[model samples]
Target: MPLRLPPLPALRFFEAAGRHQSFKLAAAELNVTPSAVSHGIVGLEEALGVELFVREPRGISLTATGADYLSYVSEAFSLIAIGTQRLPNHRANRPIALSCAPTFASRWLLPRLPLFRARWPKVNVTVDTSHRQVGFPVDGFDFAIRLSRAPVAGSAWTRLFGEQLVPVCSPGYLESLRDVQGTPLLSNATLIHVNAASEDWQTWLEATGAEHVDPDAGLRVDTIQLAFEAASMGLGVALGRRPLVNRDLESGALVQAAFNTVNSATAYWLVSAENADRRPELLDFRQWILAEAAQFSCDTSVDAAAAQ
Candidate 1:
């Protein structure tokens, strides 16, 4: 007997619409107009002989039938994706593309990436540095390192590391603020602020009881990397997130203006599409990254204990 199925295009439209519960959002996901999505769903409903959605002026909502059908449709798509990925490929040069924040990519991940390459010489890796949140499969990234207070929805998330905030500056910059008692007065120092992380400076100051320093007065930069560069050039002191400044501090290019470091609410997380674990290369990368993070965390703890 021949298989009975609705048109693949209509089913795809229905799945997107049902998942989002909005025709407009579904159209955006499918890169089609709302009218096209509406027409596709209409055809799908006619073929199925049932009402799938309840239309509203503000937006559409899936009916009980549509909600029930979506579960099965979603599972079918997952199965198809897994099967497709499992197919043998002659090409051995497929690269794993990863997205990360510019500062984290340059100051942290890139410095450590050579180690990964040494361990997995056969694997090809590509890194994209941007502040924008990755959309996983849609954005064509195999994995993403997101700095957020919480994990993003609709993906598998793993916590990589937490962050600490500290005021950092070049040695020359620090010396310029020394008082008669040989103490650096942060209140008299110029501040360099990261536009996206403006609160970090304030948070650190408040935690350290340095309320005399004005957090609002500073030269603002778009990224943490730029702020670090500005600070290194003797422009101003910057609130450096620990992970991004580790190498600089170790190399003596940057130093803590004060010994106080405060824990930050944000942390780095590794995220991938819901079914990305099915890919062997992705699994290998995940394991390697997790192990690296574990070792780094242990080293950081040891250093902190010694400092105390």
Candidate 2:
């Protein structure tokens, strides 16, 4: 007996629409107008002889049958995606494209790329750095590094390392500050701020209970990198994240202020589309990156504990 299935386009429309629960969002993902998505879904419902969605004044929702059907359709697509990656030509000489924040790319990943390349000489990586949170498959990234406090949905997420704020400044600047027992008089020194992390200084101050420090009294810069550069020049103290400041600390350009390390709400996450591990390059890179992130986390933890 011949297999009975809905049209491929209709199925694609239904899957995207169902996944997003908004025709407008689904349209954006499908690179079509909202009307097109609505029409395609209507056609699909007609062909199936069942209403997939319940129309409402405010928005649309998946019916019970639609929810069940969507799961099966999504699973089928995932399987097909996995199978497509298995093609011989697909695995050969393809660079794993990575999307990440500019600051993270500059301060952390760029320095580590040499290590990744040495281990996987055959697998190349093309990194696109921006502050924008990119979409998988649509944005054409094999993987993305996101910094967030919340769990990622519609993708496979691997926690890399949590963030901590350390007040760091130059050795010269440190000598000028008065120390009370071990902790520095942070309120007396000039605070440096990164516009991107505008609240970080205030947040760190509150976390440490140094309410005396005027968070607003700081020289602001556009980026964290610049903030660090200024702090290293003895201008003011910049709140440095562990991964970003490790090199500076090692090089003796910056010293950590004697204060309680402020634990941040966010962490770095390695994210890829669900079931994207089927590709050899992605799998290899994922394995290698997870290992690197683990080691980094371990090293940073030890350092933090030692400091305390």
Candidate closest to the true structure, highest TM-score = 1
lDDT of each: 0.83, 0.83
Candidate 1 lDDT trough over 10 residues, lowest sum = 130-139
Give the Å error, residue 239, model 1.
0.6
- For 1-308, candidate 2 gives per-residue lDDT tens digits of 99988999889888888888889888886789999999999999999999999999899999999999998988787677666666667646767889988888988888888998898788889998754445555445789998888766778888988887899999889877867564567777889888777348878878778767898887989988898899999998989887888789899999987557877889899998654666767888888888988998888788778976
Output the lDDT of residue 134, model 1: 53
Whole-structure CA lDDT of model 2: 0.83
Q: What would the per-residue lDDT of candidate 1 be over residues 1-308, giving only the tens digit for each residue? A: 99998898988888778877778777876789999999999999999999999998888888898899988887776667555555677233578889987778888788888998898888889998744445545445678888889987778889998888888999999999999999999988899987777356878877889868898897988888888889999998999888789888989999899888888888899998654576677788889889988888888788788878
TM-score of model 2 (CA atoms): 0.70
Q: What is residue 157's positional error in candidate 1, in angstroms?
A: 0.7
